[model samples]
Target: MSPLKPAFFELAVRADARWDRFSRGVRRRMGLARPLRILPYRGYGTAERVLIQARVLEDRFVKPSHLRRSLVGSAIASYKRYATVEIPGARVAVHWGDKRWEGTTDDEGFLELWVAPPPGVRPGWNVVELELLEPEPQGVPIVSAQVLVAGPQAELGIISDIDDTVIVTGVTNPLKRAWALFLTEHRTRLPFEGVDAFYSALREGHGGLADNPIFYVSSSPWNLYEHLDEFLALHRIPNGPLLLRDWGLSRHGFAPGGGHGHKLEKIRGVLGTLETLPFILIGDSGQEDAEHYRTIVREYPGRVRCVYIRNVPSRAQRAVELERLAQEVREAGSQLVVVDDTVSAARHAAQAGWIRWQEVPRVQEHQQEDADARTVLDALGRKGS
Candidate 1:
């Protein structure tokens, strides 16, 4: 914890970034790297201005659509994600309506462009076009990222975690988590029963006509962005922005501050961007989620309507800690709800009038149907063992 240690770590990180940038340039110039491609992430923003994020990288990773089902295949694809070949210092431009903004990718090959939205832009989802200006490709690859803009009628926003909150990752056990993450396809994983229905009901909102947007903030690396998006769609979960972390080491140290610091920072970004719209923060008790939510509640005051913590297997001390957070958040004028399953969350939302009571039956039905599916998923995980 010495000051010198932190200074030394910062120097190491900077050195690593510089080396990576240099080697990547060499690979590209020598025709050793794969074709440079643009990967644009779905972003969330307000009507006045929108925040867009994209990355430039060598397109060497195997496509999820073309991947075969095998431990080796999955492992290879996962390796490609982590062993990223970023194209740093690429000039980029974003266009919205008649407005245009220019930027250059940072040391991590990430570009964050803030551009004004087209005047009189409708809510819901909108698109912004982007293209590489420097280090141009053969055909000038242009891509679009989906930006979720809540309409005036939108009263609330939902920010949920990914790992155990949305899907089964066995995040508490490092081995099992790796098996689930690196050795299985998106279809092979199991979501909590009734999760889709529950989230859909929440998306329906209190007579909002499906305008309430959902933002998924996860510690999962951006390399898995496509797989995660596919999983969400495969499960019929409502789609929105996928806010994932960069796995590479940076100023925040290894793995982009891992779980706690990253999630809170992203949550703050969403709140700050949306301004007036309140939020419902969703995560699981598998880690320090409740603790993080408690901090968010205190920092934001009454801005958070509630914090939903899905119950995951944890040490007894963790349970006691969550119970304490429940009371702490309550005193902050928001509830830190601990739900055992998706059904529990749906029932609570129904009684709280966030969702209609009639939606309860559908959620229950999905829970029962998904019950058997859980066994098959567990078996798949065991096979990896």
Candidate 2:
């Protein structure tokens, strides 16, 4: 399949609008009832304020499945069984620490509210209760979500990409990427070698008291939030708020994959919120991460401590482009290191005093073991094929 261009997405937007209108008309004529459901996603905030977002959708039940399953079976189930029935014009009430914030879902059935955290609301995971408040007598009562509140003690923050950075999503090949996304299960997916250790070390920091916040900014759609969240926990990666994009069509246009503008905006929002702490940016060379990070480093001089770009085979030829970007980042007051593996990144982090020097050897050893495991898995796959 060829890559979709801007014109294709524009046409998709028009088609989607027509379909939506026709569906609404038919539903009205048939007097079909729509079920209501509230889906509260993980949120992030600070001691001063909290940001919470959720979507109102037509009710649909999804059965919980075990993490361990055949890749093909899992992919089939996910693609066929997932539902995204948005219900617009719904009012939602969010309660946290003696405060209640009310907001209405937009045309896309999404609601986002920023509320001040009351006194004595400490850091760590804070649970917020959400209830659908509109359409009297048919509202969802209690749906809870945890929000990570960054404390004042946090020394620095970490912003990293998802696909091709931590997990192996094969973004360079559209066909293979689609297959990995729709045909495989989260448990069956794999992360790059030593990423778990490298990220954990960043989270712990030098004295193990950094309690540094980590934010995962990914181009993946919000629908895959649960899957990615599970992958992180299962692989022992540090937990953080996932900033994902909505892949559906809206009044503006159809955004199949989160555009570069969307990603930059999301990253800027996080940087704006955490004004005091500097950040370490991590991404891969597979996408426009180099360009985006370059802009970030220029826009927020002295705020970005280090920029790490993990090399992908398809992007190897862009070494010159990356070198230029590296110079740009350096001129803007930050270091950009283009490395082929996570162990090198770990070593750099150690030298920069972001992590302990002793952790480097452990990361190196684990990476070697991961490589061996991959060799075995590849051999087994070949035999099966």
RMSD of each: 2.1, 4.0
Q: Please give the CA lDDT of all the candidate structures.
A: 0.83, 0.80
Give the per-residue lDDT digits (tens) of candidate 1, residues 290-351.
88888888989879988899988888888788878899899988998888888888888888
Minimal lDDT window, size 10, model 2: 59-68
lDDT of 2 by residue, 41-85 (tens): 878878877789888766544445583366655755666334575
For candidate 2, the C-alpha RMSD (Å) to the true structure equals 4.0
Error of 1 at 68 (Å): 1.6
lDDT score for candidate 2 against the true structure: 0.80
Report the error of model 2 at residue 249, Å.
1.1
Model 1 bad stretches (over 4 Å): 5-10, 208-210, 256-259, 377-385
